[model samples]
Target chain A: MAREPGGEKIVNPNPMMSNGNNCQRLFRLLLGLLLAVLAAGLGYVLSSLPSPAPGLSKPVAEHLEASGVSNPVTAVLLNYRAYDTLLELGVLLLAPLGVWSLGVAARHREPLVDPVLDMLARLLVPMLILVAGYLLWAGAHAPGGAFQAGSVLAAAGVLLLLSGWWPGPAFSGLPLRVSLTAGPGVFLVAGVALMFAGGRMLEYPPPFAGALILLIEAAATWSIGITLAALFAGGRPVAGPHR
Target chain B: MSLLQPVFDIVLGLALLWLAWRAVASPDLFRGIVLFIAFGLVMALVWVRLDAPDIALAEAAIGGGLTGALLLATLARLESGGGAGTGRGKDRESEPNDE
Candidate 1:
């Protein structure tokens, strides 16, 4: 360590430790080994898992079949696991609020722009939105559902963010509050009404079980998709005419 | 679960880990952030393969999307005063946080 013209010894921050070069290399090697072990453990656990059968979650299986949703996952997500769907919507809605809150130190709002990206967004957003609707409609018989469909819409929001097309927010305190609650709210109403009539939750009298599940799922899917999209868009209040 | 799911899990999980490594190893903060977002999406795929679709949902939303936004926003915040943490002055970014 050489003294300056002012006669002070330069206290080196890291002398032998140039830049944590070996520290980083060691970290990478450790991380790789850790991941490898994780993968092996996961494979073993998954292999040991019981395969799908009639007895494995029989209630889900039977209720799913009774719902007339040709796809069992769709039935599980909408009918048996409808509460999860509802809570997921609440989570989705809460997410943007969290993001926005983290940005309390952020400047209010900046003008978003990118011409080429905007043009591409124009081409894609409509089609993507249409597909989200279709997934909700066809979930009963297909491999898709409100969650997958909503994710697609969220991707569109990313495009809009890149292109500067989104106006941001779509009535958070009211519209979001309503839509987020609507799915479970409808399911609860249906359950109570069904119990009063048939003495069971989600158990319709006869042929109605199929119809009822479908109905509840459809509403749930719509609410989920819309709420998710709005959340993705940052919950900025632009659903209605903002001009 | 589909037979292909295991293959997807193994491949995607490795890919995710790779991206995360690159994100930390990158010489540019912007590139690091982008790579991290990609890493998050791949992790979400891993969750899907693990038969935990609910975790996938939360991860995709928060891990990939919202966290990406936050990272970019923080980078933007450092536009005025830069430091090693911000990869300011220089165009390069350093390694990952203390995981």
Candidate 2:
């Protein structure tokens, strides 16, 4: 508050930044207190909650043997809720397609000449590929899965790109499109083929479920890897002579 | 030893809160983004502590790693386009008003 020449009291227009940082400090203190109170309330409520029952765990486990995967998470993801997985793959495919639709040909980024980066890429890329393969294979009985493995593959691709070892144009055109769409395409065909066999859409016969799931996971992993790398590249890779 | 777990949990909770606050309130955009990435990593650790390994893996990979890379890449692109220091200074001034 201040007194004007007219003898009237007036409030300051800018409370913060005019008081030599004190006002801003006070404001932050108040905000922090408010947030702390809210967090405490939430924590208190959550602490009183009872343990949740296994709503779908029993059913999922009961049918796990028939789902053809030893891991319940894999069975749930690739078998019971296969439609959701298919749609997720569709979303992955759509992202790169949208990026490509912008039609900005990627400007050639100068490849890094740093020895350290080159050595790191050389060492890590092969290891990443091996781990991705192992993850995909182990998803049947472990926490590893296509998404995690695909992300590792994508990381390897990003590393290669950053090191300038793999140029963006090398992955353009028909092969790119095939790899991008292979997941959803394979999934769709599998689902339709099931219909011919008197099984519902996306329902694999118990005997063949494991093999079909492995195929779908492989395709999805490859597609996801390509999609993520292409998104990182930021433009539609133009078809070059190498392609 | 059993009591140590809750103590660890409390410490983790406070660290998470501090990281989140710093990430959101930092004036420097690049610093804020880096803080956000760190927050994601800590959150992944929390997921691990909660016994959700799958979620922990995804969060670390996508949320921390990929997102940080994407944000840095975007910052570089913007800087290259509009000149340096645009991320920290003149963010509001340089951005076009879409509305």
TM-scores (chain A) of the candidates: 0.64, 0.80
* Root mean square deviation (Cα) for candidate 1: 9.1
Best by lDDT: 2
Question: Candidate 2: where are CA atoms >4 Å away?
Answer: A1-50, A105-109, A166-170, A241-243, B82-99
Q: Write the per-residue lDDT of candidate 2 for residues A141-172, one digit (tens) a residue.
A: 98878888888888888788778855545557
User: Which candidate tops TM-score?
Assistant: 2
Instruction: Provide DockQ values for all models, in the order shown.
Output: 0.13, 0.28
**Cα error, candidate 2, residue A157 (Å):** 0.7
* TM-score of chain B, candidates 1 onward in order: 0.74, 0.80
Q: Write the per-residue lDDT of candidate 1 for residues B1-99, one digit (tens) a residue.
A: 686877777788789878977776665678779989998888888888777665575577657876687577556544534322222234433333221
